[model samples]
Target chain A: MTAAKTNDPPPPPIKYDFLGALLSYLVPGLGQMTQGRFGKGILFFVSLYGLFFYGWLLGSKKNVYLPDYHSGETSIVSRLASDLYTRFQFVGQFPIGMAAWPAIYQYVVSVQGNEKPPLNGFMSSPSLEELNNLQRNGDKTWDLGWVYTVIAGVLNVLVIYDALAGAAFREVRATPGPLTPPNGGPSK
Target chain B: MTIYVHLPVLIVVVSLVYSATRYDSWNKILREALHWGVRMTSFLFMIGLVLYALSTFL
Candidate 1:
């Protein structure tokens, strides 16, 4: 009697790693490196961080910041909503991890009315007049700079996802049958 | 020219980063990056042409 072939059971869902995702979010490509994908991690590091920092440099260290709201309104939530609308570029930049946090710190300090003299303008928002002056100058480079930063952050999000979800396509598959050599030699 | 000075770097970075996410091997990554970079550059060029036309006429 012919024996039946037994099918293998499905593998468990250990592919999605939340810790790896968190590590990747903190440092672009780091989780993949830790997961033994050294080349991929390094590539992500160079690509995302390089783009973000280059954009920051092009902006003369003035981009990646959210301006504080002092609208004198009693509703904190409404004020936050309004400021978020105006400073939406930061939403794109925030995924870049610690490199973008100084802006948040500055915004929070200024919003809470504890903006100190020691704050040496590291990611701090410029005054309305100063911002208007810069805008009036029609410097297209500044606009492009922040755009690069946003793109870097957005792209890093994909890196984080890769760390969590693993590769998009399976790298291995079953070969149906052995073939002859390219030169038409017999199969071994 | 000043505005577009950063384009080449941006193009390379974006294409590489994007392609890296979809594949594991360096061979595939570099090849896909080239395809993505070319397509994006062409698309951007088309947009620039439109803008240039608008500027010239209006």
Candidate 2:
């Protein structure tokens, strides 16, 4: 009698966790933690948050900000240029989720100027002269701090992708050996 | 001075997060992170040195 062939089990269905993605967007690494990836989640949390706070500490919490758009500049070109240089950094900072909320809130307050006791304390826009003075006097900490914070946020974008899609690539198990001739000829 | 002081720490944080996303194995992640961090720091140092040399000459 011929033996019956055993069918292989089907692969598990891929489930897209939208809520988890949202959680991660709201708070870095939350999605991974929700998906039981505690180690990865914790790593992202500590690293991203640490970098964010380090930047804040270095810059006195004033590095992340939007330009004062409503400062009554009527020239479109100047306004656009100012926004590009001053506010465009928000693009990088936005991905860090809650870590960036305070900055966003401060930006809104600065733009509206209606809020009593603005959300940002001691956060005044430094004039060009003052900035030059700071740089000349060897106070380049603010520039470096701003860059670090922006980079941290950019890194979170990758972390968020990993959390949502899982690891980008799988670990290769087999050791790669040197190629051999088809007929097992003498090795080169 | 402050910028240079934080450069190594920033490199480590960046490498750790970057490698963690690329690999699932903790051992592989840590190993790759150190490798990447060293590589990146070396690259930056080389660039800085080149720039300084060019500035002096030009």
The candidate that wins on lDDT is 1
Chain B of candidate 2 vs. true chain B, TM: 0.86
Give the clashing residue pairs of candidate 2, or none. none
DockQ of all predictions against the true structure, Cα-based: 0.84, 0.80
Whole-model lDDT, candidate 2? 0.77
| Model 2 misplacement above 4 A | A1-14, A71-85, A120-138, A171-188, B55-58
Given candidate 1, what's the lDDT at residue A175? Answer: 48
Candidate 2 residue lDDT tens string, A63-130: 76655654676775675567656667778877888877765565556666654426434444444676
Q: Which residue segments of model 1 deviate by more than 4 Å? A: A1-14, A117-119, A173-188, B53-58
Residue A134 in candidate 1, Cα distance off native in Å: 1.8
Q: Pick the candidate with the highest DockQ.
A: 1
In candidate 2, position A128 carries an lDDT of: 62
- Ten contiguous residues minimizing lDDT sum, candidate 2 chain A: A115-124
